[model samples]
Target: MSIQGSALPARPYRAFLFDMDGTLLNSIAAAERVWSTWAERHGLDVAAFLKTIHGARAIDTITRQALPGVDPEKEAQWITEAELDDVDGVVAIPGAVEFLNGLPGDQWALVTSAPKALALRRLQAAGIKPPAVLVTAEDVARGKPDPACYVLGALRLGVPVQDCLIFEDATVGIRAGEAAGADVMVVTSTHLTPMVTAHACIDGYEHIHVQRDSDGLLYLQRLAS
Candidate 1:
């Protein structure tokens, strides 16, 4: 369960990009509540429905699962409202605060599938103040696995895509960052097992440390297991 033995070596980069839901915010409990009701209404297998929600737009997931002829955006909006109201179990991922504090504010940004409003609420509920540069679902024409969101995030941060590192916790987000030509690291907090393909896997920021060089590159190192 620890990154002590088989973790990746220390690395450096110009900027760090992060995903919200599974990466920084641990809101699976709230999310499951919303999605459970949605799946029930649509007569979908709950387990399969949950898997499709990760790292994807709510509209996209709902449209794909809802019965034919349903207004996907409308259904997605209903789910979003439910999610916004169900902030009961929202919490920040372990070590996320310290990790963000250690990095220069301008050197990092957030990219998420949630709309800006929902993203703000969740971040605030988790006590992670929204950063200056946040790329939400509304920011891009497409979501994860398309590379558009991650690519836009890097552009907003004024960093070259290849010079950025992505911290994500879902299969789709990993694929997105990879497609954007950036190194990706998966956080093991949500998925204790390392199943996703990434450059490396980490438990959380607890075992990881960050330092910035005069050249404006951040160095990330993992503690001894």
Candidate 2:
């Protein structure tokens, strides 16, 4: 699919919500290594497993894709521990650090499918600071495409869901953000295919600048198309 290079209309959004793995931090290699190894060990189909696992929670993927009778909790715990053990290749998405650092700390939050421990390690590996409000997989009963995590993030940030602008790299995450009533923007740093539904798609945060007005409304400006 061709890249969608349209402009996201300016809005007076009160908060920015971010997805960790692909949107803010590039962890494709590390994740692929972890999940594929788990899949191989369980004799599961690697192609199908990789396809659905990226955007959702490990437990959800295990229950849906892993073989029958597998203990979802145990499998999820193993994957989470494995991820934490090897965050060596994870790094900040281009422009992610600057863009995040520029925002008002309270006006932004990270809502990720990763468990809290794994999420914190990845952020540290990428040299990105965890936001004041972080909604992890453990924080919600359901994961992406469910909107539970995103909704919780908004509430924790003390902002209305409708007042949020979300940055996501997966279709499932986009669904969650939209369902949460926030305008979702896709980041192409991960998936390049035309598989996501979002207000706009950006290559990375490299060309985007963010600030807040006197009234605390976030001001977002894309320096390039």
Candidate 3:
């Protein structure tokens, strides 16, 4: 699918960097459930809490929102436990499995704010193995909107920043990708709004401009009309 905005050149994209929770995996339900439970426990409004922390790191969110009256460390642990316990609804995002399975192992990696333990559990719950090169929270000093994660992911894949394409579902992640000198493609897997998607190369999974072939391999192609 040829996306609108700026007509990106048909360059050879050597690496595809992806965000985990809302990008490759459908873990948002579990996330919301976890957040709601924690919010209710702390007498906070669920919807408002989700809105405030939707695209931020758990540590940052805890420090800013869950701290003061609550122990940030303890609240984060509870959320982790809650999310793992409610992994029943977690699964790969539409076309995600096919997309990952078809890609060359060396050409892609996961860049996520999720810590390694949570990332592992979510990937397992989704029935997919972690990609060869994953930049989890443990791997980064800073989180999304800082560009560190995307930069590390691209470096791990041995690809130039300009040759990478990132798929993200959050505004922070989108900005991270762009800041890392990559093109950003946004997928609305979570509670994203039309206005939030306005500056992104947003598209539905069905409109993804790439495909898998018979050899169980993936390749990028422009969507033709």
Candidate 4:
């Protein structure tokens, strides 16, 4: 089942850092729902607002979406409330749970733009409890496209940034991992193109496999046959 001539060298990937929203879970629907509701309530275009805020932090999005006379902090609070309470459309991406369960908690962590309360709530709705280190928006001064989240995740995992492998879905997340010096793997859950151009496309767990024991130790299986 090994890839006989793949360009990526076969090596033991020491650590794993994961992006939450579009990467591990299909939360776009939920995100859109909340954002749309807020936008419509605020007399903003839902479509345009979503496009502007995709892959951005809530505070940044709030500032961008702020009405001429509205307070940024007030708008941000509203966004947090709307997003945290809206989970109707949240669901795990294909193979997400399996991939997570197959990974050792000690070797991996979740790095997300969402704050801890929101991230944990979404993970719960998606039915996946986050493991050891969960780096949220509050943990960093800068969001994705800035490597702080990935770097923090690696540090919390007790692994060097160079030894970490990141799984992300957005260009920003991928860039963050790359900036952090981790080997970045992109999943196509939310991507629209064919040539994903990140690290790899895990079509299914059957293709890119993993295994975890009772003690939480993990190992990757051979590539799909």
Per-candidate Cα lDDT values, in order, are 0.84, 0.87, 0.74, 0.75
lDDT tens per residue, model 2, 1-225: 225656764887899999998999999999999999998998978888788788899999888864777899999999999999998789999999989989889999999999999999999999999988999998988889999898999999988988999888887898898888888888877774666353688778888897678899987787855
Q: For model 4, which pairs clash?
A: none
Ranking of all candidate structures by their lDDT, best first: 2, 1, 4, 3
Clashing pairs in 3: 1-223, 102-218
Q: Write the per-residue lDDT of candidate 4 for residues 1-225, one digit (tens) a residue.
A: 111232332445667788888878878877888788878888987777777666667886777654788786677778788888889878888777877787766888999999889999999999988888999988998888899888888888887887877877777777888898877666666654454363655533435666545644345565646
Q: In TM-score terms, which candidate is top?
A: 2
lDDT of 2 at 14: 92
Tell me each candidate's TM-score.
0.93, 0.95, 0.84, 0.84
Report how far residue 205 has shifted in candidate 2, in Å: 0.8
lDDT of 2: 0.87
In candidate 3, which residue ranges exceed 4 Å CA deviation? 1-9, 196-219, 222-225
Better of 1 and 2 by TM-score: 2
lDDT of 1 at 18: 96
Which sections of candidate 4 miss by over 4 Å?
1-9, 41-43, 65-67, 193-198, 204-206, 211-225
User: Could you tell which candidate, 1 or 4, scores higher by TM-score?
Assistant: 1
The regions of model 2 sitting more than 4 angstroms off are: 196-198
* Tens digits of lDDT, candidate 3, 196-217: 4444443445344565455433
